[model samples]
Target chain A: MTRLVAIDWGTSSLRGALLDADGKVLEERSDARGILKVPQGGFPAVFEALFGDWMGLEGARCLISGMAGSKQGWVEAPYCACPAGRVEVGRSIIDIDVRPGSRIAIVPGLRDEHDGVPDVMRGEEVQIFGAMSIAGLDEGVFVLPGTHNKWATARKGRVAGFRTYMTGEFYALLSQHSILARTLDADAPLDEAAFLDGVTRSENGHGLLHNAFGTRTLALFERMATPELSSYLSGLLIGEELRTQSLQAAGEVVLIGASALTQRYALALRATGTATRTLGAEATWAGLHALSGFLDADRNPP
Target chain B: MTRLVAIDWGTSSLRGALLDADGKVLEERSDARGILKVPQGGFPAVFEALFGDWMGLEGARCLISGMAGSKQGWVEAPYCACPAGRVEVGRSIIDIDVRPGSRIAIVPGLRDEHDGVPDVMRGEEVQIFGAMSIAGLDEGVFVLPGTHNKWATARKGRVAGFRTYMTGEFYALLSQHSILARTLDADAPLDEAAFLDGVTRSENGHGLLHNAFGTRTLALFERMATPELSSYLSGLLIGEELRTQSLQAAGEVVLIGASALTQRYALALRATGTATRTLGAEATWAGLHALSGFLDADRNPP
Candidate 1:
């Protein structure tokens, strides 16, 4: 029987999963009602439309993550500072009333201000927890690849700290708005060789600003085809992301994200002389399950 | 008496200087009729409206440099490849008829393909020539900072090879479009101390992808104010540009560009322990004069 509804409502998309008490997904739904698109005072309506079917189950509760817990979301869950674990995160969850007999809990994001640079992440914290528990790793580096890719350290089943590289966002802006946009083939498949070439090129002593021009110059001289440019650019960006944190110099990294992005990052990491393991979107389920379990134990005092 | 019209028609603006045969300016005009704003088949009209006053003088020939000679400009003066000197460039100018018995010559841009990364420059070649001639340097590195900064090797009065770094363009894009945009003061003056702090941070061995996050982090933490972020970003980009070319390791650099930009680059170069001499926009005048003199000497057989 369904006992919980889990929603990963980010800035641009909404994803929901109906789960049993055992943390197994019974049914899933995804839509475009992300926090940014939700009309004012319409969060409850949208949430009901997406997952109302599962709400009839006895004692069913809603647990939402991602930007839905942000300041702009339905409920503002203040960020929990690191080093935090499932217990801390569960304790920090902000409760909200959705209807007369229904309720929702929004997970708070995490912030790290240790390195003199403020770094924060919302949905990825739970994902990291799931990745760590599933991988059976006591401590390691976790990479969640997306618009703002998160690189976090999991020490003794707790998140110590993490840094964010706006690699994916930078890639999007450059590919769409910069001069290099004209020379790109937007629909081309990934060319592995070109991607690896760009990965290797990232090791060039010149910085990224200098290296970015290579995209244009390569196309101008016909050294690299327009279709291949995108893959190469992806490699360069991911490679830089890896280099920034010295991830390759670290022993191993567990990549948590969609399959496609993780695969690209895995390829880049391996090419850069690092080992990698991957966990899919299921990691979020496992992470949220652990947090919900913590909340249950806390409430019953057993 | 006016014998030559030197025009610097770049991507956004056109600058014209009427000059006597002795290479001294007699009058000048500037307008926003850059190549992008020109309507199809309307280049002659725009040129006339801007520089028509000086055209009535007898034997006044226009020597046009910059984007007016690009493929999208009035006439495509093909790029002359490096190791090209003034003579090679002078020979490559493509002439066009603006009116009956009135002709204009467009200077060819330079391209370097030696480094496997194709690099090209248009207006800077003229500036470099002027900087070199004025400095009386037979061989040195010349840095021309602008939208696309060029670092060219000048050896014995000819361009040997060079590389292009998209430093300024990256700054503009990040300041205006990226997440870092909110952390910048659009109208803030250059903060020298903050700028140097950024230069110091760039040497931390972390790549730019990692370093860029510091902008957001600094502002978020309130360690660095929002208004100071722009200068810091400028320092980071300029520092990376210098680091890529090992410009800091180079003993001295001739900076050729507008005074404001060159001053910033000069500060970065000096902080990095390199000596710098700045040549203002007048270098463009000097460089164009040299090229026109070469053309006249070739035609008169003197």
Candidate 2:
């Protein structure tokens, strides 16, 4: 049985899963030492320290995903252009020789173009695949909410294309650094009512730049409290994001991310009368495991 | 002749003009000590140091505008509900008894409501009035480009209503703090072609949040250079701001702000086939001088 060490290494944190050939997780580990935290040329050392023992298992192979493939990561695993599925992505994996006999590789990110401008994604491609595998979906729309929220479309087992929105980052910037920060509680939990209000407000023909200012004015007029303002701001941004999307009435959006963020997206999608199914970190593990199949094919070409 | 000291004290800097009764700027002084930098309870001292001599002139009255009237400013001058012009604003001035036999007052900001959501502006109201005064027109569309860009309307010498866009602040935050900052030169001079590309990109119906991420991909693909990315981002934001405005074909926009910002706005406006006239710091001085007439009428009512 070929054991697998699957890793999701992002900008700020890292997680690893050790799985048996059946794609069943045997053990999981995580760390705050993401790509950014890794010292200059220290990726190999960090990777060895965190998952070295797991890799020692007989026939164990490792596949790293996310920012680990970014130029700033362990090694620059160049992006795989879109209309890519497991096979296309697997074929593009770049190997990094950590040791003379180690079998380790990084999954390439994906890029799609729109009107001559390109949009790129790092790790969410894995989650999309995982979500598809676990949900029995071959074609669907998926939303991954994070610092950079991505809306992706999959068709016939391949990621057709996707677009990125700075919704989450804008929320952070406005709620912590902009003037609205003065009147908002940055850490406050989601206030569904206030958030919905913001979402509804976003549909009012006024753009986000104008609607965002309302966050400050709402506080100044004592219309909304400080705790709810953050959620309201989040809603406004998420709502603006939704405003740009053309979701079909019968289509369901598969949301992949931490529950804290996906739940918000689920709520926002629900508000738009669209249904959603959410997948968490397990999707990342499942995705990396599924992609590991390509490694075996690469070793023994058809 | 009643000597006048007209001051525009905002968040980051302070400028004062010693004006004659005819609203002629005799001597002007400026400092980096905006309302935010003024030490707590130091407004009196700062005022005395910078323009106290001008205020000391016989019968000189000071009219302070901008954030100096906010809750955090020298004193909270409650906002005057809109449909406000020189008379309404002057009548609502909040006095701060600076010294015995001294006249020092802060002009109240303006608030307008749209569908229950409120939009407010402090310093820009003065600029709109000044723009109107200098342009020899009572009713027109006025845009003040700054930290919080205001799009205001005037009718019969009164500011009918306005909306605010956080374009400048968003540009600062995104260029200085957001992920796009990594690939951009935040202080690059405006690249007209790149900027126009952004403006044109925004018209594609993809919202700002989504279009903004293109900044990164454009750089990643080597399609756009680093310095041009900031200007492109600026164009995207200003373009989004313009998208929300409903400008009439025959109407002209009066832009008031520092030349650098207004020039960019003028460029964006021109892209939409709109004619614009740009004004500078002189607008603020002229605005306060024009409003001084209201102060006299307040003391001696009809």
Candidate 3:
């Protein structure tokens, strides 16, 4: 292939990277046009307007990840069942009929089940693959923190299973819309001390519904200020998410996300005596680049 | 007093009852003007507009409960500490200056602390007292469900301690604002089976954030209908709240609220093999009336 165009098109934003055959990012572009923003039958126009020149490169191929593969996206790329690795996910990469003689594919998401209930992740799968590749490890625990946080276990490069926590979304709701919003400054930056205090509070054996009310009471009692309360709220949620995992057994958790979110996770993880290593946007580019290699084998079987 | 005016002025609504010396509600009136709805310094105007006729009765004395006594309400009634019975709360009631030569008192809310973190409730304390008075039981677990659900334990005619659960508020947020809202009809009436299914699911030990995501998957995979999802979500939240309590040790729980909310609590409690007795608006009136009698002793100290 002359070039690989890797795209991470999620619910709220879209970003793409141009990488050489060696998987090094050469140029990057991003926009607010995520899958949800793209109108029906508008994906092609949007794609061409943003990345058409890059796609015009001789023998160039593009791979898109995230909600862009959902049923509501440009083309519905079905989810790959859990215990998926680079090979399983790669084989499932579906080619969409966007342009003639130019290969364009969407990475399928991954779905895991626990007691007949399903949990899913789309763009995060690529990041997981990228993290594994970057860390040069075959087995480990991976965490992707965002609007929805995912905790997954991988064995020999295959994600065995995972769970999703609505931690970030919940933080947004509680700090912005719930009764707690009355006293919290949701836009305040992270206060490490207040946050750790919240994390400590979560271990008090009273579940989240009960613990969350303390946010209001703490402020009402003047035990915590409004700005710090948001960080404290964040800690409570992140801590609750961490509570569900056997972190001590998992060893060093690999965290993948924006620096701000990963930093918070790292802090929360360390508070539990568990260690973490973080990766950023590079993981998405690397994962897409790695997945692109399987496209040729899928199109032309030996 | 020859007559008593009992009022439950909460966050979104204001209601009052005209009672005889025997504590019987002779007449009632309610308006959309809750404490939050009342304009600045408008409490007297609003109260006079709604209950002026009742207050005009000979020898009538008014007692108000709920958020109307909050710092933002008509007057700030300081909170009474836990292990408080009718006497403690009644003694703590603050008289608000509204009309000359007329008596008006605001019931103080109750505060309970666990390990330095405080949980508080205002109007619900009256309902708990009312339920105890109506059932002739001085000690039991009393649950008042509404925008905020309160679970309290009373012993020897005093509320020993209680916890607050944002269950109802969370149910509203998830069903109306979160991504799950997309597939749920928040206005649909309760579906007992679906609700019970959610309650059982809560016992699976995965916690709420993970269990809540099941709402999306169940709909995505065609396992449950959109309208029924709301009830299921409600069950999950209520179930989470219940999971924190020792229901078997509490004996028969007294549920106090509207028929709709109490009915749901009853259903959930029965699912756990815990017996429940329900009370309605009468509890509020009865609670205020019982406390009104204490005012005479407080004033005369005899």
What are the clashing pairs of model 1? none
Q: Per-residue lDDT for B25-128 in model 2, tens only?
A: 89888899998899899989998999878877898988999999998899899998989988888788888887788778889999999888899999899988
State how far residue A4 of model 1 sits from its true place (Å): 2.0
Interface RMSD of 2: 0.7
Candidate 1 docking: what grade? medium
Q: In model 1, what is the error at residue B273, expressed in angstroms? A: 2.3
Instruction: Score candidate 1 by DockQ.
Output: 0.68
lDDT, residue A244, candidate 3: 76
Give the true-contact fraction for every prediction, in order: 0.75, 0.92, 0.75
True contacts kept of 2: 0.92
Each model's TM-score? 0.94, 0.97, 0.98
Name the regions of candidate 1 deviating beyond 4 angstroms.
Answer: A100-103, A297-302, B297-302
Model 3 lDDT tens row, A164-232 = 988888988898889998999998999999999889988776889989999999999998888899999
How would the docking of model 2 be graded?
high
lDDT of 2: 0.89
Instruction: Locate the minimum summed-lDDT window of 10 residues in model 2 chain B.
Output: B293-302
For model 1 the TM-score comes to 0.94
Q: Report the Cα lDDT for residue A268, model 1.
A: 89
